[model samples]
Every structure is written in C-alpha cells, then in structure tokens.
Target: MSGIVVFGAGGRAGRAVTREARRRGHQVTAVVRDPRRHAGIEADGVRLLGGDITDPRAVALASEGQHAAVHAVSPFTGPERGFAGLDPEFFVKAAEALLRGLTETRTHRLLAVGLFANLKTPDGTPVLDDPALLPPPIRPFALAHQAGLDRLREADTPVDWLVLTPPARLERDAPRTGRYRVGGDTVPDPATARLSYADLAVAVLDETETPRHHRTRVSVYT
Candidate 1:
C-alpha cells in the first residue's frame, strides 16, 4: 500500500480524507499550515507534517516520497473584503503551487477537491455559467476553480490527476454510507445535489487505493 499525503488536513474535507485513509490501514501524512493548532490529527496515529500548500518548497517537502497527494485546500471564507469579499483567485494560486510541487517531485498521482459548479447540466452547459443555478456571491469562487481546472487540462505533465467534484451541498459529520454513484461531466441526479463529506472522502480514498478516472473529472453523490 502506498502512503498518501493530504494537503489542508486541518480543514473539514482534508480531515475526512485523512480519517478514511487511516481507516484503510494505509500510511498517511496530514499536511497543514500550522502544527500546533492541528495537534489532534497527530493523535490519530497519522504523521502530521506542517507545510503551506501555496509554497512550492513546503509542498515539495510534504510530497517527498509520498505515493499520492490530495488537494483539499479552500479559500478563507468571510466578508472581510467588504463588498468585494474574499479573493477568488486563491484557488488558482494554490492549485498551481501544488501542481508545481508535484511535477517537480515526479509525484504523478493527485486527486483534487473540485466544485460542483464545474459540472455540466444534463443539457451540456456548465452550471457555473448559469447564474440562476449558482448564487451571485459564490460565482467568483466557482470561476476561480474553473480557471484552475482549465489549466490542469491544458498542462501536459506526467501527473495522473483527477478532480473529484462534489455536490452543491456537502454535509459535514454526516453518515459514511460508503456507497455513491459516480458520474462524468454532469450530476447523476439533477434534482439532488447533496452528499456527505464522509462518503465523498470514501470515494476519494477508494480512487487513491485503485487507479480509476485518471486524467479525468468525476463527481460523487449519495
């Protein structure tokens, strides 16, 4: 079994992935920006490495010798930016930094947490483009993720990557049913865009354990 490195391990999604991977008995490394604040992760018997995802050197150090890596880092959400709100470009910056680190280290395996807005409707139009489907405030964040996703697709690298897009509403602390339906490009159920973070983490870990949907985009829903 290959050891897995999970970026943003202190975040909700990152913690879920770390927990799931550890449950599977695979060697796991949880990378966070602050070690003192996230000491609880170390108590889970997983190695806790302090590193910033936006720093190439830090990311490379965390990626060293790891078989796979998961990018679950999200931007800081708040109204501190006044009406303009948070910097939407944070996703692209973080994604590029991690990509650079992975490419430099020849860590070919990567799975990134993606936005549901990137997924298409049944009619073949990206939900991100539909203002009615996506709220006004979050449009910027969605666009930022889309930009990052576009770059990933255009970049010609040895990395075997997949962006795992979750549903619109990702519930935290929900039950881990360990069952989900996989879809390509569009959501499987147009009516329901909801999934538990635990189940989504299961899907992520499953894909990590076995190579599936490589160099592609996939979505999971309960």
Candidate 2:
C-alpha cells in the first residue's frame, strides 16, 4: 500500500479521495487546517495531521515519508462565491508550499486537483475565458485557479506532478463507478460537463499508482 498525504482533507473532494484511498488499503493521511473541525476524518488505519498548506514548514512536516501527496486545496470563497470572496493567493502559496514540502520530504510525486476552466475547448480557447460559459462573478476565482496552475508549470523542481482537471459540474456524494475518460488539454464534453468526486478520486489514485501525465494537466469526466 502506498503512503499518501491528502492536503485539504476537509473539503468535499478531499474527503472522497481520502475514503477511496483507504478503501484500496493504502495508508492515508488526512492533512487539515484544523483537526478538531474534521473529527470525522479520523478512521481506523487513517492518520489525521493538522497543518496549513500555505506554510512550507507545516506542509513539509505533513508530507514526510509519504510516497505521494495529493493537493486538493481550493481557494477560500465567501457567500457571493464571486470576486469579493475569491482569494487566489491561497492557491498560489499552497502550490509553492507543496513544492517545498515535496523537496524537503523527498516525496517524488504530486497529484493536484485542478480547475476545469484551465482546460481548453476544441478551438484552443480556455473555457474560463468564455464569458458565456463562465459567469463574470466566478471569473476571478477561475483566474486564481489558473495562477496556481501557472505556478506548477513555471516551477523548476524535481517533483513529478500531474494536475487533474475535473469537469465544471463536479458532483459530490455521487457513486464511484470507477469508469471515466481522460483527455489532454481539451474538454472531453462541453455539453455534458459533469463528473463525480468519487470518480475523480479514482482517477487521481489511478494516476498515483501508474502515472501517465508528468508536469502537465489532464481532464477527467464520466
């Protein structure tokens, strides 16, 4: 069983990934900002560690001795879920911290949960840039997500990383069919933009066991 550390384990995507990893009999560590808030993350054979992904030292300590680290951290948004509540700096800082932590902990692989907006359409245009597809209010958050992706792309580091971008409609609590399609850069289905978080976790773990994308992004959808 591979030793895995999941950052932002309290989030919807993170929880699903953690559960899937454990179901597969892997040693899973759920790294959260506050362990107290996520008491349910504690489970048999699962380790819970408290840390902030924005802090390099914290991330290093959490990542130590792990085979792979999954970055499922997202930006902190407010009620508006718009520009006013968007904080892109969080993602950028977390990306930097993950890089530092991987280097320090000797964790060679990283699997990041990326944004669908970063994927390009058939016309080679970023989906986030299309106003019709993405509302104005959510554009800032999407752009911020893009910044984090840029950090991973620009960083010259030894860590083997793959950013897995999900479809626009990521459904939580959906069944894990373990059936999905993977594509590069382009959105697999513009009309049917949907994917289950459970399946997304399956995709992330599949890549962890048999990595196919390195220092690049891939799209996954049902």
- Candidate 1 has its poorest 10 consecutive residues by lDDT at 77-86
Which window of ten consecutive residues has the lowest lDDT sum in model 2?
76-85
lDDT of 1 by residue, 1-222 (tens): 678999989998999999899899878889988889999998878999999887888888998888899999876532254326556667667777778899888887899999888898889887888877776777777888888788778777788889999988788967999998889989865557788989989999988888889888898888
Q: Candidates' lDDT values, in order?
A: 0.84, 0.87
Model 2 C-alpha lDDT per residue in residues 1-222, reported as the tens digit of each score: 989999988998898899889988899989998899988888566799999898999989988899999999875533255456556676788889999989999999999998887888888888888977677777778888888889999999999999999988888867999998999999966657789999999999999999988999899988
Q: How many backbone clashes does candidate 2 have?
A: 0
RMSD of 2: 1.5
| Residue 118 CA displacement from its true place in model 2, Å | 1.0
Give the C-alpha lDDT of model 1. 0.84
Q: Which lDDT value does model 1 have at 12? A: 86
Off by over 4 Å in 1: 77-85
Off by over 4 Å in 2: 77-85
